[model samples]
Target: MAYENVEVIKRLFQRLFRDEFPNLAPAERQAFEAQLEGRIEGLLRGAAGDGKPTDFAGIIGLGPEGVQPFEDINYPRIKPDFDDSVIPTQLHAVAELYYIWQHEQMKIFQVIDVLRRLFQLGQLRIQRGPGARGLYILEKWKPLRYSRRDRMIAYRRAFNYGTTPAPAGAVVNNNFHFQLVAFMSAFAQYFRDLMISEVIKGGVALSERPFGSAATIQRLGLDLRYALDRASYGNILALTTETGQYLREILELLDTPDIKRSFDANTKWDVVEQVSQRHLGGQAELSQRAKMAESGRRALEYIAANDFSTTLDISVFHAEGKALAQHAEAWIAAYRMTAEGRRFPGVERQLRWALGVGERTARQRLTA
Candidate 1:
């Protein structure tokens, strides 16, 4: 399905580029289109399918040449050292895996860049601040991650972002607000691993007797290892992208004495308290949903209808929900700090509705 979307996008790009680059000679235009097609297909081939490599380097666009579809072709392993047993074969395996992952990520970024260009988003006033932007991303992703009612709730929050404001003493906390998207986006793409990692980290506990079995334990260990590696890859991808600058800026903000003081020692306690309450509330809602279904078949139907993962995996849902809430809070606080918070302009509301709640909400959340 995603491959189909890419194909559609490629077609659109070809059409748009032809119109935009009319000055190019016929041969030059044809060559450029070929280049674009080649790059997109190569990247897709390189991307990992189901947590395993496609065994292709998947290098997108221009780079150092002679990088084989598999890294082993470029960096063949040396023979095993029977005597000293130094520089083992496992090291080569690890290296090859790393390179393949890197190249796949490179392709993801490249594709993202192409979309950004197509959207012409650079012309927009994205500098409105992190709070607004965070809200914007939440709105954008809600459709991708939620169902009808859930998505509508997200839409309301996005709407509120444009018109809400921080209370007198409340902090907008842009540091937390802006970087939310980058982390959440990365997490969304790698949530299976994130769930596994949470289990391994003691953040989520298993109650079943199966977990006590040696086979189960061994399988869990392997899963945890893979989750850790995948999480690392996701983090690296997030931190290196353009939005990742927000993550860097967040750290830099903490370096300021006054800004650092804004977060009291009780912040951790508050966060934990909020998370616990929200998790319980979510569980209650889930139970209510189950009752509404009233039967096994209906429950399956409900799950099928829902756009988001309705997995019994509470840990993953909690993490995702919390991130969504955080972005919403940040956006609201920032909106409140601005003039738009006092009384939202009706025209703006209409415009927001037309643009989709997320876009309007994000725009409204901008600092005055």
Candidate 2:
């Protein structure tokens, strides 16, 4: 078996060896061997003490749990990379455990599903360099080998063969791109550390200009021309989220320019009202346009059906237009109930309360 014996593992790998390196170039093999050994040692430590791991035998173990809370399966396949060939154990016993054990498949690659939400995460890293491609890399959990630089390099690499590789440039393409991914990951880690400090220090200003590897190095190069200008950076931060954020952006925008100063309640409300009006029309539809439109229709129907007294009841208790939409529904409901006569009891009470034109009825109120 490919697993179960170090000799078996070696032989299997030897088959893929296009060329053998029996004479490993000095520490080349040593570094690889040490990292592999360390990975195996990590796996062993995970297995020795545990109640029982479902995939105990098949996996080399991830971390100390002997398994990671990788997948949310009810009973099994909870950990992934659990039984992967890259388990790193060259020992015979561990190999045997892996080769002999049987388990359900785990969906580890599905983790990439979160990439869609990557935009909402912390700021993206924009790598700019000569001959670099613009990339918008979504920040993700660490220990992953991706970086901002890698994404940017990917764009540059894209030109080597474009979408499909060209026959003539195959060799050059392979060398340039195949080796650039690690730098991207390293840059990401460094950027993440920097962003956190900016957020705490610059607040909303930290997100001035948003870019990812999808951006061009030329664009960044031009931008960097004035990157040293703190005033420019502050103004840009106020308009769009960007790095090299200036704390003064918040102060200037608030007209407080003084961090040591504080705004009173009334002054703060003025700021809120001003900003609110500025952003009033910017609220995009939360879901599909159809869904939001339908919700709006239902909201108006509920308001027109009921008057203010009853509208309050529906908005709080029923889902429809906001506090303002309440009375319209109650007004509508009351109009319909008037024609119904006694069919709609307590309808008038709601109508009166909603309209604010009259007192609440003695017998029943909609809220009660």
Candidate 3:
């Protein structure tokens, strides 16, 4: 019970697209990890400011006043389980959910909205050109929206988009690889919304029709909303966070040039608002991670196993930050091209890919 929150964050990361991110120079990647730690510290020490009710924010952490309250508060000690079985489960739930979301949100005009959410999430990547001179886009996505009708619709749709069989050339060929840990990390936290509630009901000898957040709403035909604490809150957030990141990654592997154009076109929102969001999402939850694993993210996770919400917080922060960074990188890489469709390095010509880009366009960019 005490370790519930930490479990949430761990599961969130396990569901991410970490395999493709190793593209950075080893040193650069190390540096990226380092920066992630500082961010981790800020994230876990959440937004409950000076002289405020401690319970108001998601988690209560050592404030800028710089003091760990280990003495004043009795830490709830619990060991977390980051098992392997969780990965496949997380992937299945999210993949299913995404199939549902697409059915609902992908209007002719809103395809751009869906794609933009994915691009901004930095979960997936796009093929722009070849190697060093080649560029790729990060697939970032927004969290999926859930409503009673949407959930029912999703159930009806399933993950099989069997409406039309497209020609082989029309579909982008992508072998989207994900790190095992990222995969499990997400499942350990998120699937609870769709599964563990039943487990809890069984444990408590309650009804099969368990009540969630919108219990009082007539939508689900529920009677009352149940009370939740660190565990459930962290679980939903982590699951949503992981799925959002995944959507971003998938989008990147797409060569939706028009979508890319739209993101660039929205240059009006101001740097502070835009860049800050790109680099600093989910920080409230993730920053507290100790400087472990290059950044404090996994490191903080190492120390705060007993503090469930804190662990979940840092994980959520990391997922959001990574997605935003990847999206920004992918979008910017588009501009770093030439008429011949080549970037700066010879690698582009060699890879001959467009991970998310259309093939001919990807070739032009790579050759440029």
Candidate 4:
């Protein structure tokens, strides 16, 4: 009863689609299922070339080969004195915090503010404004999309936890990192849903208003539209995980005496400014992180003062959290399997690409 068994995989897929996309029409659901089935078949064929039996295990490279050394694999070069640099030594932790704020575009606070505005006004307007198609719409609250490569780059910058070359002072802490990712991914889903609900509740009826049709503007283009429509179901898990880990790292780094002593600060905000100036560049006054921190404080206060029990379903949040954790566990297992020699021709490439590694000039090898 391996997790990747075809039947198990099919069942999970079915449940995920049904649970996440309850609004889809029956025909549309079936069409999407058919497309998924086609992908599964293609994957199976790729894993089992030469007419071999294509069980899930075999596809993941767990046939008789078992685990073998990747002796031929080349590892990325490490700079001998990379960690000795002053900037990396004192500023790595704060840099991580800055990265999280900038990379995520302050999504948590943005979502909270949107919800706050919607509930306070009893209704929020989302009509398309002047732009190519339209801009500053409610749908912009969805998570920003990043390729696997981009995600991996972020990982390297923050925690230096993969095959890619990390910043000079990149450090790794596997258990902490994984936990952080898991928590963040779950919260991302939670906040995303809240934002979506508020937007729909406030904007759905506005379609009948004088300029209501403008609310349907495809300003973000089709890809973003599709992502928003689906509530970013495909990649929300990954995004949250990335955000969570960075946040945890930032906190942990800041707690260290070395980092604390480096800054002559009366408060944590001063520490933030010092690090931002030295490592991240830009003045703290005009920095995006500064704006996010200020707004985020206000949003939190609003949430604390308001009652949102009707909109915030703890049960649903728990269920989504469990799903995200399970998804992350399975993907991590698959990554390990692929790294440990259960690889097919393109399997390794695809996995590495998705994880944002193995893109360097020399073929990068995975290490445990």
79: Cα error in model 4, Å: 58
Question: Clashing residue pairs in candidate 4, if any?
Answer: 61-342, 185-240
The C-alpha RMSD in Å for every predicted model, in order, reads 27.0, 31.2, 26.9, 23.6
Which prediction has more favorable lDDT, 3 or 4?
4
lDDT of each: 0.33, 0.28, 0.31, 0.37
Which residue pairs overlap in candidate 1's backbone? 57-69, 164-336, 165-336, 166-336
* TM values, all candidates: 0.17, 0.14, 0.17, 0.23
After TM-score superposition, the amount by which residue 211's alpha carbon in candidate 4 deviates from its true location, in angstroms, is: 5.3
lDDT tens digits, residue span 1-368, model 4: 22234445567667877785678764465466556667765544433322433344544568566543333112222224321222221222223333354433323333223333443464433223221011122235423345445655544444344566544543432222332223233333334444465597784222122221111111111211122222222333455455555444434433434333535555444555555555444333324344433332232222223222222333343343443334333333333343231442232233233223334622444443
Best by lDDT: 4
Give the range of the ten consecutive residues with the poorest summed lDDT in model 1.
Answer: 295-304
**Candidate 3 residue-wise lDDT, 24-84, digit = tens:** 6643654555566555444333321312333312235545444435343322432344321
Clashes (N, CA, C under 3 Å) per candidate: 4, 42, 68, 2
For model 3, where is the 10-residue window of minimal lDDT? 220-229
Ranking by TM-score: 4, 3, 1, 2
Question: CA lDDT of 284 in candidate 2?
Answer: 22
Q: Is candidate 1 or candidate 2 better by lDDT?
A: 1
- Kindly report which residue stretches of model 4 are placed more than 4 angstroms away from their true locations once superposed: 1-214, 217-225, 228-236, 255-261, 279-287, 290-368
